[model samples]
Target: MSDIYLFYKPFHVLSQFTDERTDEESPRTTLAEYLKVPNIYPAGRLDYDSEGLLLLTDDGELQARITHPEYKLPKTYWVQVEGDITDEALTQLSTGVELKDGRTRPAKARRMDPPKVAERSTPVKPRKGKGTSWLELTIMEGRNRQVRRMTAHVGFPTLRLIRYAIGSWTLEGLKPGRWRQTTVHMPEQTQKVTLKPRKKGRGEHAGSKTTHKAHPKTAQPKSAHRTPRKPKGGR
Candidate 1:
């Protein structure tokens, strides 16, 4: 089976194996320090500011399967926005958004009323006379800060972003800086085939002759504490 890891990366930690700017006064934490296994790389990158389930694997084929755009794995996010989300904004997000880069794919977005989300340690700045709202969005693409950009485009700037799930894997029970290993059933092309046992060679018999012999007996050594010929000699 291929080796795959699910890491719950904390906010402000770089996703790279090593920090390029290690000379700085405060170097960023990286995945290499947390994961000791060798030859594994991240399937895709999560922005340093975002926190959630991040995938790593030693199998390049599995990595390609997950990160390649053609596979189209869905990523679910729990987002907090600056203002109350309108039905129009939800519709726009579901339909599509025309960003400067290009039009994004249609997404699944909905307002989460009475959101059952964890409170952030660092609260976002509250605008005057404006209330915040929560939303759950699932998208197929992994663009840079796409969730935040999309929300901002819809006139509701995202204040906090947390990814909850990726494909069938979720970040349940994983705390910040903690990780877990999970197995994914890859496509047939990626699975390894077991070879059948070869037939016995010529002159090899099913039942081979065997012999057994009784073991030879040996004299036991006397203990050092035993007196030798005590009766024959006087002290």
Candidate 2:
């Protein structure tokens, strides 16, 4: 069986399990501090300064689905910006924001009341004189520092950023530095259930074909290079 972990990552912690920084005067915080799991890898990197839901898993295919740009999984963030954001800025974000890389795709953007997320382990120190407002912005593309750049392009610099959700998963009930493991259906498995019906079996309803063709072995990257298997039953 494969396992997926939803971690509520906190501010000031590196998204990586190991800090590759060789010049650090002090030990920096990393996922290893809170998560002791072995072998599982984070599907995507959240900025060290950004806080919120991060998905890690032991399944490579699952990881690819969650992280690859082709899937277009929607990621939403609760962003606190330096200005009391205006509708004009929201409209620009909803339409498209031109970045150095290129123009970002249209997004779902709107003002939000202050969110009830846990305070950062190190408190956010906003600029002394500027006012701030919150925005709930959803984007499908994961360009580097995209949200920060988009808000800044429109003259409202991001002060504090919290990723609130990815796809259908949310940070609900998870607090900073905490995590929970759960089963996620592979896309094919989900499709199988919706595509057809089959012969009934004992303890199952009539015309039921819901069971997946279980491999029993742990899930692996479908396209990863591995030694060719000998013929089944070894001739």
| Model 1, runs deviating above 4 Å | 113-121, 187-235
Backbone clash pairs in model 2 (N, Cα, C under 3 Å; residues 3+ apart or in different chains), count: 0
TM-score for each candidate, following the candidate numbering: 0.74, 0.80
Q: Give candidates' CA RMSD values in order.
A: 24.7, 10.5
What is candidate 1's lDDT per residue for 1-235, written digit by digit as tens? 3556767777777777776674888877777667776677777888877777787777665566667787677899888898889999999999989988888899999878644545455667768988888899999997778898999999999887888887756666566666665443323332222212122212222122212111111112213342211111100
- Candidate 2 lDDT over 203-231, as tens digits, reads 22223222232232213224543222211
lDDT of 2 at 156: 95
Model 1: lDDT to the true structure: 0.67
